[model samples]
Target chain A: MHTSGSRIVRVGTSLAVPVRRRALVQGLAVVAALVAVGIATLTLGGLGIAPERLPAALIDIPGGSEGFVLKRLRGPRFVVAVATGAALGISGALFQTVTRNPLGSPDVIGLTAGAGAGAAAASLLLPGAVSVPAGAMLGAAGATVVVFVSTGRGFSSPSRLIIAGIGVSAMAVAFTQYVVMLQSRDQAAVLHAYLTGSLSARSWQNAAVIGGALAVLLPAAIALGRRLHLIEMGDELADALGGKAEQTRVWSIVVAIALSAAAVSVAGPIAFVSLTAPQITKRLSRTPGANVVLSALTGAFILAAADLCAQQVPVVEDLPVGVLTAGIGGLYLGYLLVREWKKGTV
Target chain B: MLVGSVLLLGAAVLAGLALGSNPIPLPEVIAALSGGGDAYTRTVVESRIPRTLQGLLVGACLALSGVLVQGITRNPLGDPGLLGVNIGASASVVTATAFFGLGGHATIWAALPGAFLAVGVVSLIGSGRGGATPVRLVLAGAVVSAVLSAYIQAMTLSLPDVFGSYRYWVVGSLAGGDTDTLLGVLPFAVAGLVLAVLMAAPLNALALGDTTAATLGANTTAIRIGGMLSATLLCAAATASAGPIAFIGLAVPHIVRALVGNDHRWQVPLGLVLGPVLLLTADVLGRVIARPQEIMVGVVTAFVGAPALLLAVRRMRAGT
Candidate 1:
């Protein structure tokens, strides 16, 4: 029952390897699960590629039927899913840690809605005035700023943040819908599809954009991982322990916003992956602190699995992945709210 | 204050009739109302009249329900739409159209049951053995709304025919309301309003806290159930009549509460009058802004209502 502080397994000190060993094993298991799901996503689609040839097909560079499916269709989609999921997972972990609330996620805080509004404005209002990703990033930043300023106490009060986020979210969504309605019918349909968060027709370009973002942001989040854990001990205590609490909070939020905006730009606002992933990972790892890596893995797994389900589910084929996540996540969110209410923390 | 609210409501109703894609003179509107106008004037006035009436009814219903819900939950932010009633009605209507093959007037039937079922589930989950607190009710409502919204998205995506009509309806407009529809929904709205008025006194008693209210001879549980039922009924009728117009239910009560003190007796009636005023004003504004192509009232209300919500949140935080 080592509940004195955040569970710390000091490497090279040789204090206890069991806790560290457990984390390592859990990480490996999650990785294995991710790989299995990724493989399933690749091979289980309409393309009837044999399982034995999957490894070879994945590696084959030139031009073959299997290579075309692996590289062209499934490969990019798989990469985008993993990248976006990991981004959301990491961002969710950072935000939850900062807000000290399990419900604190990018989507919950209106970042995704802001990104959607930005994308809508760029595509509809500006019309090639700027790139979609840049627009989304701007929107995400704007939403974060609004939430921050509106909260008055910054990240200290979780409930105030959520309420402010909800208000901002409503406004952003209204603006997006208004912009959508202003466009031509076909264009409006395109915007609507994007808003629903589909992986269909995703390109290697999308994959590269998200992958590039994760490349920079993931490492940055991991580096702040220790500070994030410390800050979870309360700001004064973390400051006493030599952690730059405010600096860490700001940096974590910036990284989280960047990751979220990048994902939204590529995949639209994929609902609840950022939210459910971290909580699931925390429960699975049974750890006292933010499990950034494990959360990323869980996010990747959930999004990939959800994408797979969206593609393959009978009668629900080609349904936007966001719908599935929102449907499942909504129920989970309700349950969490009830639990939190019972505990008198909500 | 009540007289002022009634006057505002009257002005809003007049504005709704007088302003549209095709504006009518006030005299012409009056003439049409008195059943003696030219054919073109009659056609235009007749078309606008039902929508205006529908707006008034729906707005009043939503506003009154908002007061009851806020009173029962004891949460200033409590709104029928926020409490999952709107989304539930929407999801039900969408499902009815998409799967059950029901359409047009038949959708209202679906909406009523759906709205009630959703509120029922929210109450059951939100209310533990003790009772549903404001926080739990809100969280429950949000969760239900999210799930139902997803269901709506899925249905609309799968069924394009449904989507074509559902999209406009979901955004909420008074354009679709005809005299027949208006007349049909009127009974339910009136019934719900009556129920709300009847419960207002008990609601005031309940505001003193459950133990005190009980000691004061108010049946707290009965009041809660009665209030919830009335609110749900009102929300369903309004949503069915004109889609899910956002913000009015949430915002109007706050406005009314601000103008009139927090007496349920005063708040309920004032909210009833002022709710239509806000809704009709937003609807008329929506018409004026977009011109030939009117924006839906729901969108307009969001634009108007969200700022009010932010203010409400700020005030709530400050008070606490």
Candidate 2:
């Protein structure tokens, strides 16, 4: 997974269990579930709007009572959650599948820290959202490179890759804290929210940026995802089957990195998306070979649920969508940990 | 081995006692250390003495805790940092700080129970029917830690006023605190240490793997429970006094392993002694490097310990 150029294994098409029709049906159901609930949440409110007026709020056929709240507040937030979850889920699945390690999520490997560094550099050291995203991309790449380099000799070992990732993540964390310390206390306050992975005060502009990214990357992931499935089988077999292991792996990483960076830019390193989403999706669906699409759908559904709860769930007001996800994800994390322990020889 | 580690521990304590941002003469540092002059005495007593003692106590607590955990889980990498112990403690402290206007030493007391609760929750979930595996223990720890960290994030953002001072404090400092806290939590720390050292016999047996340890006539359940409780106490006391520091727990055991081999008998004691030695040294170095402004010990240790981990892991692979 941490090979110098690419750690892509050759996935043989002969072994490729074609996407079954039943799984497709199930996936569509999941996606439809996400959309239905998302819309429901977007419309439902405590603003004294009658439940019957919800349909009007959707079409804007009203005298601007409930329409303003739905369209102005919840609409943008819903779009943000869906897009963020999609990006994180897809990125997470790709990260785990490519690394062939369950724990190989963006946060665990220092990608968020990198993105934090990138964002901080843009806000403080550098300037512009363009610079922030660019810096995030750079930070993600830098962390990946460091992890890869540290574990280069044992490139095929999942354990080494993760351990190396831990080191890089630690370093990135220290760098981030140092940067935060250097900034004016005011800027530090702003960055603190971003660091916690909140989607508060998000407007259409933020939604548009991430939604536009989904517009580009989602299709690419679909088109390229099949080839990614091939890369998972092992490099030698993949090469024998007329695939360039290096190229496939590189593109898979590119797709994964792009998606992860998109999520980081939007949600400020809401980590477990990539790690948890793919695992949860695969486990639930029991359909293997990189459940990228399902993971994305699951990510969207989870985030939408979390975001809606964040808005209305009286448990704690203004709890970030990320916070709920982490709390829920923590449970899943425990399950996975136990499972990993069960599998371990030690 | 014992004498060497003890000598090293002594040297570390003396260095810690001597060094600080305040430039006291080494001799006067010794004199002040030995309870000598008046104003110089107060300076040493107030700043240097407490800081060094805290570093020493905190280091030992962290090391002993790490060894306890690593022994129980049988994972080389198991530490408070990796398992989210620090994050749990910090989160608990943050919650207390936010909820109650509990300031100063009260935060430490608040932190202790929270730290124990976090550890207890993770252990229960991870233990299941099959007992604790290295992977499960870590995963459970990470999950709990990650969850609490989110709460910490919310606390930081929502309570910006409370979080302001805490941001620096959370980074793990060894200065400008009430030294009476050192004496306050010292009993728990000492008791935890004593219990942890006593468990060396069972932990040593368990080191041979769980079934065999059972075969060796050790009460597996009792040993594990006692060990975990002690480790939690150690971590809670340290976190209460100094905030949650990483690397010492995570990397100290790994470094100790390299020094000798995987014998709990030696590793535990060496880790107990050396953990503080490393932390004290790191604390002292933090003082000397930044001049008047001190680098937080947490940052210093990660910077130092991570490389040690990398080198150690690299060596492990090569040795294997």
For model 1, residues A126-155, the per-residue Cα lDDT tens digits are 777887667777888898888877777665
Candidate lDDT (C-alpha), each: 0.80, 0.73
**lDDT of candidate 1 over B1-320, digit per residue (tens):** 89887888888888898898889999988998898888888888777878888888998998999899989888755789767898899888988888778888887788888998999988877776666766567667767877888888887776777777676677778878888888777788888999999998899898899889889898887898899999998988999888887668877777777777678999988988888888899899999987898888888887787667666656654523
Candidate whose DockQ is highest:
2
Models, CA RMSD each: 4.7, 5.9
Interface CA RMSD of each prediction in angstroms: 4.3, 3.8
**Total backbone clashes of candidate 2, pairs 3 or more residues apart or in separate chains:** 7
Query: Per candidate, chain B TM-score?
Result: 0.92, 0.92
Looking at model 1, give its docking quality level.
acceptable
The clash count of every prediction, one per candidate, is 0, 7
What's each prediction's TM-score? 0.82, 0.82
| lDDT (C-alpha) at residue B127 in model 1 | 79
